[model samples]
Target: MTLEELFYLHNQTIFKYLYYLLNDEKLAEDFTQETFTRFLHYEKSIKAGAELAWLRRTARNLAYDHYRRKRLIQFVPFLQGHEEQEPISPHQWLLQQEEAKALYLAIRQLKLSYRDVIILRKIEGLSIQETCDVLGWNEGKVKNTLKRALAVLQKQLGGDWDD
Candidate 1:
């Protein structure tokens, strides 16, 4: 497919995935753009019919890199002030619904593996095989991780959590 077609088909999904992973809308937008930019550089190397998976993996890596940089910045007093916090947007306010906010916060508190599995399987509605492809995990690992992630989420959310 052409670049425009590919973007049209997968951009929102990629953006939302990044947003969920990063919990920063502006950063998510930046990473989503970077993900597509990298795709442009490596498009010829990517296999056909696997574009979504490739995009997801790329986005995931970018989020992880961002987390690493942020963690490192925390230790360097000089670099800390260089990062500016953006004002929260109206969309962010809309996310303040009690249950939704609680769930989002709970997910953010999870370890990376658990958070990723929950986002891909439950939030993004990716199938087990698709999630495995994006995460580079075997089927068994994906299933086990997803089960554990759900259990943690349920516990974190308490009585409000429904199966």
Candidate 2:
């Protein structure tokens, strides 16, 4: 497929995935565009039938790399941006709900592995196979990680596993 077609089909999915992972719409948008940019850089090398996986893996890496760099530079004081803000998108609305807000905070507190599995499986609704592909894990590892991640989320949310 052409880049335009691929972007049309998968841009929203990639953006939502990054938003859930980062919890920042602006950063998600930035990384979403970066992900597509990186895709174009490596498009010729990517194998057939793996475009979505390629985008997701690239996006995930970019997000994690940004987090790593942010941590390293976080101690340095910086001025806030002076630009005007854009209107909130629908994904931002979900975080405004009481339960969702609480859950989001709790998930953010979890370890990266747990948070990633939870977001991939529960929030983004990726299938086991898809999640495994995005995370570069086997199915068994994905299932086990997801189970443990859910348990941690349940405890963090102050609810029982049955809830």
lDDT of 2 by residue, 1-163 (tens): 9889999999998987777667678988999999999999999999999899889999989888988988731111111223366777777745545555576677767788887787777766789998988899999999999888888889888887542
lDDT (CA) per prediction: 0.80, 0.79
**Residue pairs that clash (backbone atoms under 3 angstroms), model 2:** none
lDDT score of residue 76 within candidate 2: 12
TM-score of 2: 0.79
* Top model number, lDDT: 1
Worst 10 residues of 2 by lDDT: 72-81
Q: What is the C-alpha lDDT profile of model 1 across 36-145, one tens digit per residue?
A: 99999999999999899999999999988887977831110011222466766777646644556677677767788987787788777899999999999999999999
Model 1's lDDT to the true fold? 0.80
Clashes of 1: 0
Q: How many angstroms is residue 51 displaced in model 2 relative to the true structure, after the best TM-score fit?
A: 0.7
